[model samples]
Target: MLVIGAGLAGTEAAWQVAQAGVRVRLVEMRPVRRSPAHHSGEFAELVCSNSFGALSSDRAAGLLQEELRRLGSLVIGTADQHAVPAGGALAVDRGRYSAALTAALEAHPLVTVERREQSELPGPNQITVLATGPLTADALAEQLRSFTGRDDCHFFDAASPIVEGESIDLGVAFRASRYDKGDADYINCPMDREQYLAFRTALLEAEQADLKDFEAESAHFFEGCLPIEELARRGEDTMRYGPLKPIGLWDPRWGDVNDREVRRANRAYAVVQLRQEDRDGRLWNLVGFQTNLKWGEQKRVLRLIPGLENAAFVRFGVMHRNTFLESPQLLDATLQFRQRSSLLAAGQITGTEGYAAAVAGGWLAGTNAARLARGLDPITLPPTTMVGALTHFVAEAPCGDGRGKGRFQPMPPNFGLLPDLPERIRDKRRRYGAYRDRALTDLATTLEQQGCAARTSSPHGQV
Candidate 1:
C-alpha cells in the first residue's frame, strides 16, 4: 500500500494500512519543498487552527472524533494525548501533537517514511491512497487535475466567522426564514436604516488581513462567495439586496403584521442572518459574511450588527487559496475513483474540511486500501454516522458536467448533511443527543459486522 503526503490524512492513512498488516510507503515533500502555510516538515501540521472543534458528542465535529476514536484513528488519538486546555473543544499542543504522530508512523515496522515529492499517480495494480491535502504542490496538483479531467480544481476559501449560539441576543434576533418558505431555520437580526448605514461604514473602513505572495497572486474571489466588505464596497444598498436583504422576513416581536401601522413602523431596512453551524444549535455562522478582514477588525465591525453586540466567535473568517477536487464527479463513497478503483483520494483535497474530517477520510481510505490489498472488499460506513455523511456528501453531491460548470464545494461536518431521523424531536439538545446516540450505535454494528475490533488504543495513551 502507498500513501502520498505526510499531513493529517496521509499519516493517518499510512498508520491504518500498517495496522491492517499491510506494508506501506508514506511519502512527504517538506524541507525538500514546503507550502507557504507550513513552518516545519512535521507530519499532521495544523495550518489554520490547533482545535479539532468542540469535544461534546452531541456536536457534529465531536461525533466524528468519537467515531474515529472507536475505529482507531492515529491522528485524533495523538491529538488527545497531547491535548491542551480548551474548555469544551479539543485543542492540542501543535508541536507536541505533530511530533508524536511523526514518531508513531516512523516507528511502525510496516510503514516506511520517504522524504521526497511524489509527482505521479501509482499504477493500476498498486493500491494507493492520495491524501495530499489542500496545499498540494503544483506538479502533483496538475497531475491530479489532468487525471481527473478537471481544470478548475481550486478555489479561494473565504469562510464566514462562526459565533456561539448562546451569545446571540435572541431579544434582538428572531428565528425566521425568508418568506417563511421553509422551517424557521435562520436567526434574523433586523437592522434599521441608521444601523445598516453605520455597519456598512465600519466594514468599508476596517483593516484587511495581508495575504501571502502566493495567495495575493491568485486572490480572485468567486462571485458567489464574495466577502461582505466587497459587497459593501460595491454600493450602499448592494448588501441590502444581497445577504442582508429584509424583504420577505418579518419579526413577530415587532407586533402583529395584520396591524398596518405596526407593520409599516417596524419594517427593517436590512437584516443579517445567522445559520445554525451545528446539530445542537450551539454554533451559528454569519450567513454570507465571508471576509478578508483582520481578526480584530472582524470582531469590531461585525459586532455593530444589532444582535451580535456580545457575540463569541468560534472561528473567524479566513480567505486563502485552497486546492480541492470536484469529488462528486470523480470519486465514490469509498473514496475510490470511478474510473480507477485502485486510486483513492482523501483529506481536504476530497472537499472534506476541518482537521477531524480529514482524519476520517484518511481512516476510511487507508482501511479500504488495505482491505483491497488483502483480497477483501472495501466497506462504506452508514450515512447516519457523521464520518459516513461527510464522505457520502463529497462523493455524491451534485456536480454539473462540462467545462466551468461544476458546483461542488468543500464542506465541514454538520448535522444538516446527515439523513433525517425517523421521528421528529423538537428540543434542539435532545435531538442532537439522539443523533449522536444513533451514529455511535450504527458505527459499532458496522464494525462488528465487518469483524473489525470494536476498540483500538485509547486516545489518552501516554505521550
Candidate 2:
C-alpha cells in the first residue's frame, strides 16, 4: 500500500493501513518542497486556525468527532491528547500535535516514511491512496487533472487573519451571539454608519498581494470562501449583508434595555465578529474576513474597525491555490476512482472541507485500501452517519453537465447532509440529537454485521 502526502488525511490513512497489518509506504514533500502556506516539514501541520469547531454532540463537527472516536481514528485521537482548553471545542497546540503525529508514524514498523516528492501517480497495481491535500504541487496536480479529464480542477481558497486578544479594546467590543443564541462565544465590534463607510472605503482602497503565475492565469475563487475585498467589490452593501450584518445583536453598553427606543436607536449599522483562535482567548480571528491583502495593508485597513485600532497581528490573511477533484463524477463512496479502482483520493483534494471531514475521508480510503490488500472487499459506512453522508455526497451529487464537466463544489459536514428523521421534530436541538443517535446506532450495526466492531480500540485510548 502507498500513500502520498503527510497531511491530516495522509497521516491518518497511513496509520489505518499499517494498523490493518499492511506494509505501507508514506511519501511527503515538505522540507524538500513546501507549499506557500506551510512553515514546516511537520506532518498534519495546521496552516489555518487551531480550532476543529464546536464540541456539542448535536453539532455537525462534534458529532463527526464522536464518530471518528468510535472508529479509532489516529488523527482525532492524537488531537485529543495534545488538546488545549478550548471551550466547547477541540483545539490543539499546533506544534505539539504535528510533532506527535510525525513521531507516531515514523515509529510504526509497517510504515516506511519517505521524504521526497512524487511527481506522478503510482502504477495501477500499487493500490495507492492519494491523500495529497489542497496544496498539491504543480506536476502531480496536472497529472491528476489529466486523469480526471477536467480543465477546471482547482480554485482559490483564503485564510482569515488572526489578532492578539489583549490588543482588542474590550471596552468597545462586547461578547455575544446573534439574538443571544447559545453561548456568548463571539466578540462583536459594533460600527455605526459613519464608521462602517470609512472601513468599507479603506478595504476598497487596500493593496492586495500578487498571485503566482499559475494562480494569476486562472483566478477563480471558490464562492463559499471568497476574500473580504472581493465581497467589498460586489457592492457597497454586500459586506453588510454577508459578514457584517448587525441584526439580532445588542451590546449592553449601548444603553438601558428598559428604554426600547433608546436600545433600538443604538443598533449598529454593521458588526465585525472575532472568533477565539486559542484556548486562552489570546488569539482571535476576524470571522468571514478572509483576504489577500498585503501584510502592511492588512494591518492598516483591518485596524480601522472599532476595538481593533491598536490590535497586534499574529498572522495576516492569505490566499492560495487549492486543487481538488470533481469527486461527484470520478469517485465512488469508497473513495476509489471510478475509472481506476486501485487509486483512491482523500481530504480536501476529494472536495470535502473542514479538518474533521478530511480525517473521515482518510479513514474510509485507508480502511478500503488495506482491505483490498488483504483480499477482502472494501466497505462504505452507512450513509446515515456523518462520514457516510459526506463520502456519498461527494461521490453521488449531481454534476452541472450531464457528463460531469462542472458544478461540483467542496462540502463541509452539516446536519442537512444527513438523512431526515423518520418523524418530524421541529426543535433544531432535538432534531440534531436524533440524527446523532440514529447515525451511531446504524454505524454500530454496520460494523458488527461486517465483523469489524472490535476494531474500535484506539492506540491513544478513547477520545
Give all TM-scores, in the order shown.
0.78, 0.68
Residue range 1-463, candidate 2, lDDT tens digits = 8999999899999999999999999999998997877889999888789988776768888888888888888998889888888887889999999999999999999999999999999889999999889888889988888877854465454557777676789999999888878998889999999999999989999998998865654456455667899999999999999889898777877677447786688889999998765334556778888788998999999989999999877567766677787787789999999899999999999878889999999999999999999999889988889999889878876545622222455667776567668998968678888998898888889888987753444333322
Top candidate when judged by TM-score against the true structure: 1
Predictions: Cα RMSD each: 5.2, 10.9
The digit string of per-residue lDDT tens for model 1 on 385-427 reads: 9999889988877554623333455678877677778998878
Off by over 4 Å in 1: 159-199, 205-210, 220-226, 238-289, 294-317, 399-406, 456-463
Model 2 TM-score on a 0 to 1 scale? 0.68
Query: What is the C-alpha local distance difference test score of each model?
Result: 0.85, 0.83
